[model samples]
Target chain A: MDNSVKLYLPTDAAHIQTLKPNTVVQIYGTLYTARDQAHKRIAQALKNGESLPFDLHTAAIYYCGPTPAPRGKAIGSCGPTTSGRMDAYTPLLIEHGLRVMIGKGVRNAQTVESIRSHGAVYLTAIGGAAALYQSRVTACELIAYPDLGCEAVCKLTVENFPAVVSVV
Target chain B: MKIVDSNKIRSDVAKLITECLITPDRAVTNALRRIDTDSELEAAAAALIVENNDIAERERAYCCQDTGQAVFFVKLGDGVQCVGLRDALDDAVRQAYAAARKSVADPLTRLNTRDNTPAVIETELVSGDTLEITYLAKGAGSENMSKLYMLTPADGVDGIVRSVVDAVERGGRNACPPLVVGVGIGGVTETACTLSKRALLRPVGVLNERADVAQLEKLLLAKINALGIGVAALGGRVTALAVNIEVAPTHIGMLPVAVNLQCHSLRHGTVKY
Candidate 1:
């Protein structure tokens, strides 16, 4: 097997620039989970000029809604959900220093342009490979919006999480 | 007369839900392993899919987090008497999604039903004494991309092909590439949608019994793959794993076609009792 391109998270401009589309990569380190409901809340928070959940500059957003973890497991089936659904809120996040976005499926033209102009990269976690991914996460804990249930914002520490660069 | 207890139905459906959500379908896994792709990304994609199947099976973990809403298609036997069918399924869904996450929601209110209750159940009466249940934990990603088309009868076979292909194109990467495209041709709007979804219950790569319909399936599959959607829409030759088409006679003036797309995960199963 070819060695996967290593990408440690809290990614920098230099690191993000080197990555090319379609290249297989394995990410390691910290990220935040935000999906539909959470995105709306984030937008609302921004509008209100309130404190944001996590520092967008240093934290990547994963469009996911993981299952409740079983005993002795950090998480359960932590797969990526459709990224397209987040198109409306992504460009704003990109503008706020978000460098990396990870999820499955396609992004809209608007979202793609924003990623390009802002020098942000979008990665695709294999949609069906959730079990493999859950194993990669060493720790997971609630970050915000716990009432949203699985859609709540959470922090994850992953190691060797596999993905492919989809947009840059 | 055959007596099928509702309690047995509840428990059996619960087991089926857990199994279908956690275990990769045998035919789909086989197809993924059998992928012959020259693209490096395609090769990588296939490897991940194969590895995921093994992990899910070994750990008895969900293949994807979405777990989705429980959608059941049932064939009820004429002589088999079972009351409270919906109640039994509701119990089963509540039991199955209890530990996992609850995805079903009140659309207008956006509050989850909590236990993923009130599964979408469709039952048909058949001639035999056995009750056969097919379950699909229909997730949001691909489900969101699915479409319904009302074409004019003049659209005919070519129109059907065009409609199905168009849906895939629009779905693009959003529906999850390496898709299982289910085409429901004919019927009214509702039946067309149901048939399209039911087509997904067929084993991966299986053809319809009708020769012409089977031929259409082959042709449509080729066209979808040719779109170069690839796995995860990353870009490659294999966009779809299979295209299964189901058809019914419709009114002469209208051609109701619905396209249901299933991601590569393809979590589904059949239980007969």
Candidate 2:
């Protein structure tokens, strides 16, 4: 298993290394953020044939709704929420050429199956390492759905953004 | 008739809530200490921890927006009868919620009905001159995954371990990982369940009175981590932060064990008056 890769947006899972169930990996790079509300909006946009605020192809999505940033910081302690909540929407994202997902919790059978079929990797983040994570986000900006508060879709620029890739 | 100061109770509860908001709890803080290497699990945990803190800070929110079913374990002191202890406690919760709501969002969703109640009170009268209240805000995720089992003597420790571990496994990614597992042993059926929940009140990494039980906690901790449940079950080595067991003497034929878990967003505060 490759020890590391720079995670990014718009990347296709099929193009990356073959991902088996429960393989571990370290991810570092820019990743798009989303959670319950944000995922719904993205899917809705896809359904309408409308261009999403950000491209899904070749992208990595972190399932999260981050709090506002501290003074002079890029972001607050941002942690991944539970992944099971997004199980229904993940396969669709995978179909759109999404390559990696960073979050916590187990995925539905179909979600894991989609990863295997699509060559996608799922990364596990420590569920409560909020403040420590904020240190890695070198840059951040709201890209869409600003009204969603913490759930608003945003773009995060990270460096050596550590994550364990588990294929389970 | 003994009289207790109701206002003191309100003040104490409010103070506890505020302090809890400002600082990340020990469970999260300790877990941060373990993220030494750049594994997928640590990175995932690091990434999510930032978000958790951000919500706690920027959102001006509770450490977990699921302020939870605020369950308070209150100990009433002897000779000190507090007028409206329950009402005053509830009022304190209400006030704290109002004071802190701007920063922390409520945990309710269109899918949920409990919405915004802060603390559920479990009062016990003890011999003392001061009131002691332990506030545990049971977050929605892990609380939902908590389980209770009535095992025959045959189920044994292995069975208990399996039940607890299986709960975490079946809970999968739902109960946020690096979970603080509270295992209650020996009590009768329902008492076992209550013990498990109360066991969560024990600080992370705290051990049992019995060396055997403490060893069991360590054993369970190792096995659960081996599950590769990782943070949020994305998969990794650190599926649980710690395993804490609280045991009681049980009926001759019963080996009841209850397992309750606190997710990464474990939040509890204490107040003494």
Candidate 3:
């Protein structure tokens, strides 16, 4: 439990593999936010032979749906959603070069195997720590799927975002 | 007779929702404080959860982003008269959600209601003139894992225990670990399910009145924790914080058991007027 690992987004597969399970890490740089609906859309697009909304290389996806920001705050109370819901679309994203995912809950066996095989790692954030996590978000902007409301895809700039490597 | 005003009730209800969201219940917070973790991973995770609650309170933010569906349990007094009770509660929910800027969407269409409304209201007419309302903002993660089973009489208490453990095992990380399991035994299918949910309204760590029922709760909790589900479904010593059981008389031939899993956030509160 060193708890000192600092990872930059778009990290390489080799780097991800070196991280052990339960290793606490502070992630820096850009992290894309997507939940069940956005994942479905991406999976469907790939099925139809279309490009994804953002390049997956070295990208990290966070399963979250934040409340509306009151006024001057960078974001509202933001925390991880259940990752199990995204188990169906995860392997596909990993195969397409997804290197990191931040969420809570257990992943299905297939998703775990995909993470290990595809050089991806799944990280768990403290599930209910919405305010603490939101405090780390420096900025947030809607990236895609505006119609999904809180479930929309957004790019979040975070500093020292806390998470534990669950599977690598 | 207590003549309650609709407007007053609406405002009070709205404020109650906000209060419950911003502040974690004392009983739940105390339970988290008492969690003794076996592994460093669990310890770190537990620390973060405790810190999160403090931050949420100081910053007036939600403990979890998924503010959850609005569920209300109301006990109306016979001598209390408030016109348009349902509409007032609905209006309160709408206003509260808008004020908090939380999301509530249509289940099928995924369309945001803009304001959370049409709260699930369960009402009971009691004896006194005081109106008691309990609010539970149930997150979808745990709510999705809730189950109901209609067992034959032969299943007995052992059967009930096995089914409860099975539900927790299958729920695993999906429902969030270190959970509060609400068990409802007896009654028919729907009654069993409602009883299970109502069971959750009880304060965490409190036991049933009947000695046998209390013993059953202890047994179920110990067995569930033995599964080693831990916090956030990672490996640890504690899987469930408490198991609260509520039973209702039912047909002799049927044994209906419903298990409702609640996450660590346990956002619920009560206000009496």
Error of 3 at B150 (Å): 1.4
Interface RMSD of 2: 5.6
Query: Which of candidates 2 and 3 is the stronger one according to TM-score?
Result: 3
Question: Best candidate, TM-score-wise?
Answer: 1
Instruction: State the fnat of model 2.
Output: 0.31
Cα lDDT tens digits, model 1, A24-115, are 89898998999999999898887788889899898899999999999999888888988888999988888877889999888889999999
Ranking by DockQ: 1, 3, 2
User: Which sections of candidate 2 miss by over 4 Å?
Assistant: A1-4, A12-15, A18-32, A37-55, A68-75, A138-149, A155-160, B21-70, B83-116, B153-158, B172-178, B186-190, B204-206, B210-241, B248-256, B263-266
Candidate 2, residue A24: CA error in Å? 8.3
Any runs in candidate 1 off by more than 4 Å, and if so which? none
lDDT string, candidate 2, B1-273, tens digits: 467788887888877865665455756755655565346545544455655565456545445433445678888878677787777777777666553322224456533222235356676778868778888767556877888888888888889989988888788467877788888888687677778888877777678878999999999998888887676565567778788888999998988888888886767788776
Instruction: For candidate 2, write residues A48-113 as lDDT tens digits.
Output: 888888777656788876655656778755766777788878888778767678886667788989
- The TM-scores, one per candidate, come to 0.97, 0.73, 0.96
Please tell me the TM-score of chain A for candidate 3: 0.96
Model 3 C-alpha lDDT per residue in residues A79-131, reported as the tens digit of each score? 89999899999999887778789998888999999988877889998777888
What are the lDDT figures for the candidates, one per model? 0.87, 0.70, 0.86
